[model samples]
Target: MENEKDGELLSYSVTLNSQVVEESKELIKSTGGKLSPILNNLLKKWVEMNKVNSENKE
Candidate 1:
């Protein structure tokens, strides 16, 4: 169902450290992965981490 698929989408706003921003910027500049793609990747990572952590709490 659409709702199930939607649940897989990553959505968040996480504050990044200055060093992390600089590192990600460098990666984007060198790899040309585009800003949105980089951010999307980070968001997905956060979602996965949260899911794993929440599951462990059960």
Candidate 2:
């Protein structure tokens, strides 16, 4: 499937800490933010950081 502008999409189920999830929901609601974008940005940053670390290690 395709995303609005990010091209293809993949679905994965992840387990997160309950407390953190609750806190994140509250923060998102208070700030009028959407969860998907927040998660996407976080995962993208994590992937980039890991890639850089792996390259440096090689």
Candidate 3:
């Protein structure tokens, strides 16, 4: 699938705690969502928030 923010798709690996992984899996299944896009959106929101905060401090 194409990414909305940037028209590119990339894949990588990371490690997480077993409990968090299990909960994330259940949440994804219940919400009918995929992990990659969900993580992408979350990271994007985090970056945006940090940028806004940084700008406000200046």
Candidate 4:
């Protein structure tokens, strides 16, 4: 499948809290969603919010 990565993708592994993972899995299933875009959007929003807040504080 074509991804937002423009056909080039990277993979890595990390350890996460099992409880967090389970909760996230339930949320994803309930939403009928996938992980990649959700995570990407969340990270993007986090960065944008941080930038805006920093600017406000400056």
Best by lDDT: 1
TM-score of each: 0.40, 0.40, 0.39, 0.39
Across 1-58, the per-residue lDDT of candidate 1 in tens digits comes to 8866654442211222333445655665676655587685885465556555554544
Tens digit of per-residue lDDT, candidate 2, span 1-58: 2464332221111122333445555666665645578675674455556555544544
Which stretches of model 1 miss by more than 4 angstroms?
1-35
* Full-model lDDT for every candidate: 0.53, 0.47, 0.48, 0.49
Q: In candidate 3, what are the lDDT values of residues 1-58, reduced to their tens digit?
A: 3464232211111122333445555665676655578675674455556555544544
Write the residue-wise lDDT of candidate 4 on 2-56 in tens digits.
Answer: 6646333321111223334445556666666555786846744555565555445
As for lDDT, the candidate ahead, 2 or 4, is: 4
- Give the Å error, residue 38, model 4: 0.2
TM match of model 3 to true structure: 0.39
For model 2, the stretches where C-alpha displacement exceeds 4 angstroms are 1-35
Better of 1 and 3 by TM-score: 1
Clashing pairs in 1: none
Candidate 3 deviant stretches above 4 angstroms: 1-35
